[model samples]
Target: MLPWIQLATAKVPGGGELRLMRRGEEFSIRLDANELMNSRLGGSEEALATLACQKLAGRPRPRVLVGGLGMGFTLRAALKVFGTDATIEVAELVPEVIDWGRGEMAGLYGDSLTDPRVSILQRDVGELIRAGAGRYDAILLDVDNGPEGLSRPANDQLYDSRGLSDARAALRGGGVLAVWSSGPDDSFTKRLRRSDFVVNEVPVRAVGKRTGSRHWIWLAVKT
Candidate 1:
């Protein structure tokens, strides 16, 4: 059996450290004891893009915003499903994650980062949402373990009413806001409706099969 090796470490804003670890061919990014993402597990993250892209069919030159860049799963999925005409912007708060995509985890990312239709920003996704109104065809958030913040305290605001409102305002009419979570959150579903988004909760398999841990993807459309 191969032992896990520490590849690199980075500090998260608001006090937390992310450690990148590898065991044979598998890699994982962890915050303290919690594994935030793994190179081998990105089914729900990929679903977060596809589900939202499905709602965007027929929308010309669609523009999408992705809140996280964990191993490029969502970004790669979005690039494939959103078409070549579509433009995708990824706001990754942590810089090291981006480095990982281009460096240690390059195999998992492939050429997704260098795609001409995609842009990578080192800023927080919330700032971009707050600054732009009706700016995107879809806003996909796979940040911080769902609506509940795990790595950073500020991530909690992204799922709050005000944050939800900002996300709504950031989207074009009929645009979708998709969020990926490790589990279900009934309260968050209710809050999405209260924020004026028509919400649907879809369950997904972590390994993209019917036999793994169930994750949730929330598809909330702005009417």
Candidate 2:
């Protein structure tokens, strides 16, 4: 068996640590001791984007904001659905992850970073939402666990009432806010509705097969 190699490491904003490991061609992101994200047979990012786009049909030349760039799967999927003139701003707090994607995982992403349509911001998504008011046509958040913080405590703020409010405020009129989660979040759906968003919960198969692990995506449209 090939030995697992430590590709890179970074300290989380809130005392925890995140580490990336590579075993041959596969990579995984671990928070503390447990695996937080895996780039293997865990699930399908394409399916997630398909569900979100279906919920956001008829929007053209949309300005998109992606909260996280995990493995560049969601970003690639979004680019496929949006037009060439569309802009996608992806905010990732960990700089090392970006560096790793550029150097080690470049083959997986295929120059997505260099794409003119994408603007990579090395900042917190919460701060970005707070500063960007009524700007984006769509905001796709695939940060840490669904409505639960695992890697960073600050992530909890993104799911809270104030954070959801800020996210809604950042979207243009009738814009969609698509949130990816590992599982269903009932209370979070309620909070999204309370924020005045037309909400829909979508369930996607983990591997895009007929039967697999289930993941949830919440599509909330700003009214």
Candidate 3:
């Protein structure tokens, strides 16, 4: 078995400490005792961000809120899609994850955090959603493993009925809420529909190129 070491850092929401655990060569971000993100097999993080940006088309100054910085793939993808006038607010719970990207994962991120349009928030996605007050044109969520909540127990709330409702209220009219899941989630689709979002399920290849494991994205638009 690969050894895992807990990293020391700042405190997190719900009153606890943040840490990073290493399993073999891979790393995972954790809030207190809950795992927030695992880098080894989590490609949906990047996929959701890329697909959301792609769906935005040619919007000149789109405002987007991304939940979970992870490896910075989502933020980097958003930068590619939107121009200088655009603004991106990234809400990440753990500060260590941000540090990791600023340090170890610098090559992958390449100063996307330093982009003038990007704002990093060391806060919960739920708080950001509730506080948005229908300001964002797009909300890209890549926080959980799906509706199943594999990474953390608290994340389950983010995929539940109330959470979906909050997400709907957070978006402007006609805005899109893009969620990245590891696999298919029919119940989540039903939940989205019940929340008054016109839901679209999209399948994307893991690699940006053609041919790879199929991942799913749920794009729910406020109507």
Candidate 4:
């Protein structure tokens, strides 16, 4: 059996450390002691873009904002599902995560990061949402452990009432707000409703073969 090797490390802007690990063919990005994302298990993350794109079918030249690039699963899936006419803006607070995608996990990302329609912003996604107004057809948050902010304390702001309100204002009419999470959050669902989004919570498998821990995805369409 091959042991996991630490590939590299980086600092999260506010506070915290991210470690990139590789074990044979698999890879993982961990924040402190908690594993943030893994190369092999992206089922739920991919679904975040797919489910949201479904709701946006037939929309021309759709513009999408993806928070937290992770391993680029959601970004890649968005390209495939949203077609060539769409443009994607991926906001990743940690620059090294983007580097890992293009460096250590280059094969996993392929050309998604270089695609003409995609722009990788090394900015806090929350800031982008606050500045955007009627600018996106979809806002996908593959963020820090959902609303609980396991990776960084500041991530909690992305799911708070003000954050939800800002996100709501950023979207165009009939836009979708897709969020990826390790599990369900009842309170978050209530907050989504209060933000005036028509929400649907979905359960998905981590391994993609319909086998693994049940991960949740919230597809909330702006109303």
The sequence of per-residue lDDT tens digits that candidate 3 reaches over residues 104-172 is 656657879899999999988888898877888889988756778655678878888999988888887
Compared to the true structure, candidate 4 yields what TM-score?
A: 0.98
lDDT of 4 by residue, 87-179 (tens): 999999888888998899999899999999999999999999999999999999998898878878899999999999999999999999999
Better of 3 and 4 by TM-score: 4
- Tell me the tens digit of each residue's lDDT in model 1 across 7-101: 99999999599999999989999999989888888888888998998887768899999998888889999988998899999999999989988
Ranking of all candidate structures by their lDDT, best first: 4, 1, 2, 3
lDDT of each: 0.92, 0.83, 0.78, 0.92
lDDT of 4: 0.92
Residue 23 lDDT, candidate 2, scale 0-100: 95
Q: Number of clashing residue pairs in every model?
A: 0, 0, 0, 0
Error in Å for residue 208 of model 1: 1.6
What value of lDDT does candidate 2 attain over all alpha carbons?
A: 0.83
In model 3, which residue pairs have backbone atoms overlapping below 3 Å?
none
TM-score of each: 0.98, 0.94, 0.82, 0.98
Can you list the residue pairs that collide in candidate 1?
none
Clashing pairs in 2: none
Candidate 2 regions with alpha-carbon error over 4 angstroms: 42-44
- Error of model 2, residue 75, in angstroms: 0.6
Candidate 2 displacement at residue 196 in angstroms: 1.2
